[model samples]
Target: MSGAANPALLLGASLSAMAAALHLAIIVGGAPWYRCFGAGEGMAKLAQAGHWWPALLTLGIAFVLLVAAAYALGAGGWSAALRGLPGLRWVLLGITAVYLLRGLAPWPAMLLQPELRQPFWIWSTLICAGYGGVHALGLAQAWSRL
Candidate 1:
């Protein structure tokens, strides 16, 4: 069973890995690290008070993203188990759609808030859209092979 080499899976894996690392830092670095990410004073207070639910939630998301990336790669034939999974192509499609949706979802917020027009927000949104586009292309390539 061969499929086109899906670069999107690799991209997702790399991004997810970085996000997981950041999540780990957010979980352990406490108030100072959290503050650097523009989490606001309330979160800083929560971190200082040893309440890490918010970070935990982010960490959960980061972990799931990592898993999805791994699964994507595996389904691309990087692993036997992953290749054997049912509906691998459909799963890839879903992931692509999700990334695309997330990338576009910020547009409304950016339009409504002047602060979101800053370089940071623009760059982040660009990256998100780029990632989504890559994943979409990868999904199409892999599906063609299927």
Candidate 2:
């Protein structure tokens, strides 16, 4: 990895980390949080009923996001150990694709199922797109090192 940190990747890592933290906070905040975060009324109800599935699923997401953040950090040259991770390039590519795909999902949904659209969909799409854009730029900038 280069000695200099890639700012785009660093920002991507921060965004992922923040998302992971938000997921954890949602778990702590319970049903209200689920509802507030647009997790769906059913999920909120399940959480309110003390179902383990909701928290478990959310925790899994948080873990994945945290790992992605770490990978981004490593790829960005912020962490030497992480930079040595196996399949770093492929992993980063997958993460970038996932985010971009998610960001684009709402567009199709908006056309096919406008009734199901919500404010959350719009906001989440923008956020995911921004995250993916940052990751893509960083990945491109650091491609040779990885």
Relative to the true structure, how large is the alpha-carbon lDDT of every model? 0.71, 0.93
Clashing pairs in 2: none
Model 1, 1-146: lDDT tens digits are 58555676667656756767877787788888777765667877888898867677768877877766765776555666667666777776776777788778888999999878866566666776776787676666667564
What does candidate 2's lDDT look like per residue over 46-113, in tens digits? 99999999999999999999999999998999988898878999999999999998888778878798
For candidate 1, list the clashing residue pairs, or say none.
none
> Candidate 2: lDDT over CA atoms?
0.93
Clashing pairs counted in every model: 0, 0
CA displacement after TM-score superposition, residue 32 of candidate 1 (Å)? 2.4
TM-score to native of every candidate shown: 0.80, 0.96
* Deviation (Å) of 134 in candidate 2: 0.6
Q: Which stretches of candidate 2 lie over 4 Å from their true place?
A: none
- Lowest lDDT sum, 10 consecutive residues, model 1, at 74-83
